[model samples]
Target: MINTRPRLAWHRARLLTIGVAVWAAAAALLTPVAASAAVDNPAPTPLVSFTFDDGMQNALTQAAPTLKKYGLTGTSYVNTSCVGMTTVPNTCRASTDVPYMTWDQITQLQNTYGWEIGSHTVNHLCLVSVGDDCQATKLTAAQVDAELANSKATLAAHGFNATAFAPPYGDYDMSVLAQIAKYYSSMRGFADTGNNPWPLGDYLIRNIPVQERTTPVATLKARVDEAITNKTWAVFTFHDIRPSPSQNPDDYQYGTAELDQLAAYVQSKVAAGQIKNVNISKGLVNGSPNLLANPTFNNGIGDGWRTDAPSTITADIGNTGSFPDSARSVKMVSGSAAGHLFSPKVPVTAGTNYLFKSFLNVAAISSGEVGFYVDEYNAAGQWISGQFRKRENTRWVESMNFTYTPSSTSVASASLQVYVTGTGITAYLDNVQMLALAAGSTPPASVNLVTNGAFDAGISSGWTTDSASTIQADGANRGSPANPVNSVKLTATTATRHLFSPQVAVTPGTYKIASYLNITARTSGEMGFYIDEYNAAGQWISGQWKLGVSAAGVTNVDLTYSPSTSSVAKASLQVIVQGNSGLQAYFDDVRWTKS
Candidate 1:
């Protein structure tokens, strides 16, 4: 067994290891490969979660109805002390003028619309002062504990099981996280500004804030696209939904029209089986604890971890690397003697499936292999059996994920062991996660609604040009590097040229339009992109000019648009170049898809 040490000593060692140069070199060679592997392995399904904060009245009146119309649900984080208040309390971080939801109304969100109710502390006290409205004073340890425990208790009193928490102003530190872990299963933060990766950091769940004017419908749909492509989870944070929201971001309010558009876009993706729209709790898998303490190596070795042949293992190896959620990883410098790192034994059920995952950066492997195994223990704490889950032999950097189930019903607990054998093999491991694999359905294939989007055949294949311009296939001016094909080149003189795409059949839902353009030569005016709407009789009903660009370089433009009227049955993409004279441009990779 490996020896344990105090956390203070481990922190000092971690600080000492920060100056090591080898870790930086290994990370440089390993980070990109790890990122590429994450994109390549699409096993984790994409998820989108809509979460509202402060329990504002509009959450029930506006957000819930819009979400329900699309068969989607959301999570509402409420401040228990401010419920039904006409004015916000000074202790709370919410707007002073906005009204909060009544307890009964909050119940409707849970029982009627199927939304999850989470905690936002009792008085919305900031755990750490970070220069925000909630940061008037820093709370003591006792105050923090009371805020977490009492809010959860209050929710339970109202028949709500609040497992997730969002701190006021997203203010928190390691101390706050410790207290949060004691009371909540997950913590959603403000301004985290990206999608959450799979095997999510339950306590540090990140979110993208949606504010009025700043957050466009296109931006929200693009986030959904990112989740789909990366196979990650996207949590959108909203504070208030109003009929006429103030444009100031400080107000933290969003318009109902834009909210409806975003909801419709999410529904389209759900309908196409590209993403699953879930509440906060439903999005989390199993809610199981990561049995390995100090899994990320943030506290260095000898903290809930031990190794045979300590000379071969280096803790707190990397400080600046693509280590997920943390800046450190453990390094193994192996020789002919095999070195083994062991995790603390954690209780496990006999028939349950467990997912063991770790990000590995193998800088060099000359003669041996790195293996991950699960060692099973009996009820009497004796080693019973072991299973070799996965091994890496070549120079590689990727996430190693394997599912292990105990062979016998007598297996009581298990410990994860990573062993490196052979000569001259050096590897770094980080973010080791072991939890039960949640049950889920397989994702369906995604479809693109536009055809001949790359202009592969010719300009006339699936495109039309108006009388003001002459369109020809240009092999020299392509916009997309991936396509690498002929693009439609429009030449016009002092007149607006219209290049129309094939009409795509439409429904009363939001759609995303994308195209790449390069204004090779221009004299006076800019190029415009529009979505033309047509009624069932093929008559033009409405058209929205989305964007216009005049720069003499490659420009990628994409926007989300919903039909103005229900009578519209078809829509077409229009690319127009209006200039004085001698105008030339290339357009390629036009895409219109149900968002």
Candidate 2:
């Protein structure tokens, strides 16, 4: 029975009384972190947004109270067709029982509870799905357009902003979206259950459905637990919630206690600053590359963040407008034991610089040091190292920025976290972001894979070739004539001529196909290299080709490629120097590396 603390610094000072105890040792010992998670899929943050589709009356009566008790809010989708028309009470069939929300009740939830109202459609139209909430008629694009547009217009007309849509039966095509795109900001779709990656398609947000009879309370908690652990985004969909066992209950409907349990868990994590329960519209807003989702804490306590376990730290939202342009910022109060607040993991490119900035306002955080860091992890999902950013607890007047560079290409995700130490720590963080520096920034380290890379061992078993070309030991054109030659010269007379490397085994990382080309002579045609990939079973996956040329001196020609499981583990590298019959080329250190 963990009790949540009040959300503001001032309120906690006067009203602080109770605290909850937890089995911190047992929890940490049992749970192991997993890698292979889709890295920084969305704007970082483990967000779990709740949405109720089909305008059911139970949303207001049974669901709303449970949500409010847990200090939670959600977006509920409605279709204008059955806004108020519900079945008579005391029935026992899907066709005979259950109730639909009236327009008044829907408005009350929006106006009174700060809940978002989204469009389902003018009708619950489905193009393919044959489930509940499906409008079986194969609607035309124009018909779908009208349904989407009219519903959005109606909700707006009634004072609901109605920015996002929840497709009935999770059915929609590009044509349907292109039309709806005219009026809505984003759309919530069923089936796909995970975070909405940036540039956030806005057209199709994924969701997971939950029910009392099917999705147990423990399962619901586990789903959110995974999202929190991975720092990913997820949306949960639900329907009716009745007090007692419903004989003819729809699989989508839930019992009150189940909903209560789920809500209570959300509240606990939110109070601990572990995750965010946001509305779909939050992701659709002016998509940018900055990761750290819900940085402002607008989604309440649970929006994808976490603090220490079994600790006396209390967390909640607070109005920090006194700090200039402040909105809603998270407020955490430290008890005797020092606590930490960890941010969601953000994916980054190795050797690339990432810029991070954040705004902080403190309330009497005297004495102890406030620490900021970049916790880096490898592709295996294990914490490899950490980079310190801010070691001072300096009071911020406005904002601060920090930049860090990862050391290896195998680096997967980097999460931001802050440690508070000292007497009575209380603070708020707002407007934070972590962005990957664009290409043409600091360069990555390169690795050479060509055996006898300098050809010091002479033209040998490493390179396979066609009859059109041959490698000769050259001493004169290697970088300059002065040095003893360890380089090989490739002279190609035909298009099929190439010096190919044996199959190289690779893991997931960036690779460069590079060669030192000193073309003493050039005439017709193009000179290039190609990389062909193969799966574990020796099946061809894909290939890419690029060309380079320089008349005199030496030209360092190179290109990079990243391999995935989709392309398998083996790659064949080929170097082709094609031109006129006397087209001469020099090859020194040809390499492919994880850098």
Candidate 3:
């Protein structure tokens, strides 16, 4: 291993000295109060932060130039300890070289080209699983501490202000977050982009992880458009660069053309002033405005009709459709802005199906279309190809459905919009919903995946639970805000029974199954997961399960299972938290990924 530590440390120290000077310079150049004000919802489209992981050298050679050409900006999370190490020998399957982005290269990208730097830990272990035992196996607390402090110090030394981190392998639990919050202001976690308005309210931000290098640019755009429509802040996590002279090829690295296409899209958005391209940390600093907190609309609902944006209008409730109580509809009350509504700009993964629906007053105009779109960006915001969904006839009972997919997964953001292009067809919409369909696995047998679920007497639009399941608000918080630990335990019992599966659309493929569980006891109770094979006739062929040892804590389990040879097009994931312990268990983040 080439020990670049001494050189890296020295360079880092020098760079930090200079960075402080530059930040001081930049600070001096700007009116300090102006900078502060800019953070408070400055004019300009909101920026979508794009981040790449693993700090592979290709980031410099392949990803950076594309970003620079387009004037887009981004952050690359580096594993500092791997700075001077040689490419892990013969073991690398995709490229012959080891995958660490060198300290020296990182400096050039930051100082010369202006790329933001972030920490991926000292040695990139699954930070979430790193307890004392795990730390003892590889690096120590001192080492991990060094990784955290030193990487920040190193970036500062390299003239870059790194204020963010994307946990190694994008894995981190509460304990992992506790350890990280001590060092970084914000961290990135994995997210599903199928639905937008990115998961909010946390130092831990969710991101879309790009694993396929083969995805096309157009497809990438469609996905991005959808994300924006859902008003989601999209983040992309990556590793490896394309066609490198290295051994690790299968790792999620993008080809040069693909990387360029992605970057260009972001740059186009920036050039148009649709968004201000900035690093991930900056996005963290300018967190999305809590629309509800602002004194703009009543009871905290802006409804995409902004005072700042002209073509949009908020109207009084009128009779036309269904759902009578719905009020405050958007009307073409006047001007060129007559049919316009609000939308987002972030992008999403291509080929994914998304469902969008809204509650509207029955009196509003009978029908119209909701528009969904996305804009892809590079390090600089730029335009790349994307997709959109146009829903035609609106139903009085509810909102219309508009769904689409981009040709690329590399888009930066998307937009969800509604317009009354037709005359005299005004609509009143509320309780809008955007749901990302689960991909990667077929559903298991014997479990009816619930849609728009009700559990513990509370409801979420896209969740699943037994409609027949009875809820008992054991305490005063039956539906009260306090003591919200209500129970609606599944009543089904058989040789084996399962509950809780969300709307999952699956094609035939091998998949990896996983879910998050909150166990109430540390006993033999296990959450049994299954992969069922149900034919068109609703007949079950076979399925498999892995009994996870349940404990009274939030634990995410990755199940070991595969699909049967026969084509099982439609399936549901089955979960049964069964055991004599009689402890309550809650589930979240159920995932089925095509391997």
RMSD of each: 19.6, 21.3, 22.1
In model 2, where is the ten-residue run with the lowest total lDDT? 8-17
Cα error, residue 517 of model 3, in Å, equals 23
TM-score of every model versus the real structure: 0.49, 0.47, 0.41
**lDDT of candidate 3 over 264-366, digit per residue (tens):** 7766765665545557765532322221111222222243333222444454344221221222344332232224444323334444433344433223332
Candidate 1 vs candidate 2, TM-score winner: 1
- Residue 245, candidate 3: C-alpha displacement in angstroms: 9.8
Question: What Cα-based lDDT does every candidate model obtain?
Answer: 0.70, 0.60, 0.45
Tally clashes: model 1: 0
lDDT of 3: 0.45
> Candidate 3 — worst ten consecutive residues by lDDT sum?
8-17
Q: TM-score of predicted model 1?
A: 0.49
Top candidate (lDDT): 1
